[model samples]
Target: MNQDDLFIAEDNPQKQIVIVAMTGHMLLDFAGPADVFNCANRALELRGRTDGYRVLVASPNANKQVTNSAGIEITCTYSVMEVSGPIDTLLIAGSNDVQNLDDPAYQDFYHWLSAVDQHTRRVGSVCAGAFALAKAGLLNGKRATTHWDRSRQLQKNYPLIQVDPNPFYTRDGKIYTSGGVSSGIDLALALVEEDHGKEIAMQVARRLVFYLNRPGFQVQFGNLLPVYDHQNIAEKIRSWMIGHLHEPLDVVRLADHMNMSPRNFTRVFHKQTGIPPAKYVEKLRVEAARKYLEDTDSSLEEIAERCGLGGLVSMRRTFLRHLMVTPSDYRRAFRTSLADVIT
Candidate 1:
């Protein structure tokens, strides 16, 4: 079905939502999305309508309750083998226990998961659940994310998959993946918005007392400056860049500060950060400009100068290149509320 067909407005057809849980699963990873969908059903019922979703929890082991990472035991409604679909969305919950993709014990479960994907309309993972999806070969060539700590491992393990560590959630075609624990709520909200209208999703969010919609592209980590443990020379240079964003910092200036040649500085910086020096500088500048746009009512030119983007045109282009949105639009979307602003 097309994207339009996913939305259920008046008729409110029941969508089948299957959550796959495993041993050592993160409770919130499964429960967060469960709460969102359950609340969405309640919202529908308040309008004298039937529930829009049929939620089922399934597990690899059918006979016993699965013990989560938190030591909570939860019973599954069905085993993976029995949960044949017409599934609207199949979500795999994360686990704390490190997974080995090539382990013989998981081979059967992996095969079952791969088969289930064939019949599911949309398949996704919450946090480190991405490991299982990658193991099943479902995430190959797809843009995906997991917890911040696990993203590098995911990328290293599945070289074919594009692992983006920053987003709250990512969707590439019919596959989706979310970052860390609470981001499952954001992913679920996006799914609700996709399956119903924005109004229903907003109602669900309000009921849950959560942000209505945090765009998936929003940065997962808030620090504009890179964190370092030992305060190495490269880290010191990065700290200087953050403090001196308003200056006209070029390769020569940065190299001089580090007392190294421009070529050597660029090479070492890239080695330490996995990004080129120029790109890192642009990222920091854009991140600083983003905060200014969200928090202050400064003119674009003023923000540009303060964030060291040189001018308004440069800032605009940087914002577009890095964030895929204009500064004005980002401000409109993420600006603090008037009530908060007044206080």
Candidate 2:
């Protein structure tokens, strides 16, 4: 083969992927996958082979400069119209102001997506970019995922699309969807495995120092860490709640304990926490209930009392609020997952 043909062959032994970034798009979502693709290229280079992964950035206005969520700017090479030929992959990265996507830029972006649908081998969205895909009517009746924060909104707005909300990435045929920023790394690792081999993908992950390939069943990041701001009173209240799970916790009592008037406490709490005191308390209770369910051989009534639910009905409500599963079902899944980990 000639040099040009060899370049094309290496550009896509399987496919050439295009990454799309709209205005105010998330930096990490784009960067994470780009890092993986770039690392995969390095892996290919190490083997003295042709570059296997190729990525291009395209925009609606064909602007070369793209701003990130944190206001960092990145320059792009190709415009949406310039990428007219068959593309193997189309990845839409998320934006901070998702509502701003209703602008004229996105109308042009929609046309580009429609065009891509005709020739692109695979389409995917990272984070709230799923909104863009859904706007283009590409996600209907397809399994997909987006950032955990907006999964419920996506589900509410687009009932036709199945929002998994849990997986690092969901693939239904050629359409792929992934959760928020860091999950893009996992998704790209998955693609690397498919394109090359598991060993190559693992080497890429090692270069990136990634701990896990993908979380089991879309485990929400919300569950892995505490969300309270350390300097805020919400942190204090959360600490108090954790320590006093067995205590009687009510909005009035919580407000009194914080030494603020009920209304003022409620306002500040909601303003700082993005959730009401009652809801926060419920979350803490449910979290405690889950831990007990997973780690201890406690009866339902005992677990309820330990979690300070006061009654079976309250415990069930709390469990359903956080887990979307009954206490028993949650316990069963947790135990099964634990067993798998141990094995």
Candidate 3:
């Protein structure tokens, strides 16, 4: 066995996992999958097996120190040019903004990445890292995804790639892409399942305290809402809406609060938020109900009323429409206390 990259944890490895982080990468995107593969090896050892993944991180920074988005500096010792050997997986960690690959250093890394594709079995990206992969033409004509907010920009920039915005993750042939920061975990778990088996991945998920390995199509929203920049017009109304979610939130009511006619308010709201007034109200209600379901021991009817969904039927319908899962199932999945499940 030859070493081409530095290890986070290495012992009798069967597969080599490499994560590449550019300067200013999102920390979670780099750490999440690395932990997953490391845990996979731990799980395998617990089962009295020797064949498991060896995980390492590679960076493109000169000093081998990549400062993350949170302003914390992490020293990666090995640059992209230094990485070599039988790599089973190569993951590109993401950032808020894509690095300019046209720069000479990045250009060198870009070429190295494109060259490594020949032998690397699996290639993946988390969040905005898809931009780098797409720039390399690796995702061309392939079904891929990125962070929800950046999906449109990705599509517009690279028309050759089919970008699906809804999924938490995507896998087309050898290339895999995840929606946002945390979705990297989902993708890594799926990759683990592919490499070992469902049972092994399940063990890893359980060890990581993930009750459910969320499916790719699972909607990516804790709040299921987007923040807007139109502070003068929408921020005030949005804050008010959150406080008054239990109250009636029809377009007429919202319009009255803004001191505008319903028709004019509807157009302005949609233009600013990119969602209709009625739909946005439904989103607000569903988001509230989700919190109640996850946090409290409240009954469905009580939660529905508290969230202004009116009744159980309405709440269930809204949950299905936006979340693609029922309210009860959501609680079982997202309930914070593992002790609650045991009891």
lDDT per model, in order?
A: 0.80, 0.77, 0.81
Model 2, span 192-274: residue lDDT tens: 89878998899899999994364345542447234666878788777777888898887888899999989999999889877
Residues 1-343, candidate 1: write the lDDT tens digits. Answer: 2433333343557887888786787788898999999999988888987757988778765463678887888887566656555677999887766563344655667888887667778999998889999988899999999987788789998899999887889899999999888888999999999988899999999988898766536352444345655555556776789889999888889999989999998888878777877787888888888888878889988989888998777777877777767788778877767824574
Off by over 4 Å in 3: 1-13, 26-28, 39-51, 69-72, 96-104, 147-161, 206-212, 215-220, 230-236, 239-262, 294-298, 332-343
The clash number for model 1 is 0
Error of 2 at 212 (Å): 5.2
Q: Which number leads on TM-score?
A: 3
- As a whole number from 0 to 100, the lDDT of residue 43 in candidate 2 is 88
List all candidate RMSDs to the true structure.
6.6, 8.5, 4.8
Off by over 4 Å in 1: 1-15, 22-27, 43-51, 60-88, 96-108, 145-152, 164-174, 179-183, 189-206, 209-216, 220-233, 287-306, 324-343
* Winner on lDDT (1 vs 2): 1
Q: List the candidates ranked by lDDT, beginning with the highest.
A: 3, 1, 2
Deviation (Å) of 7 in candidate 1: 24
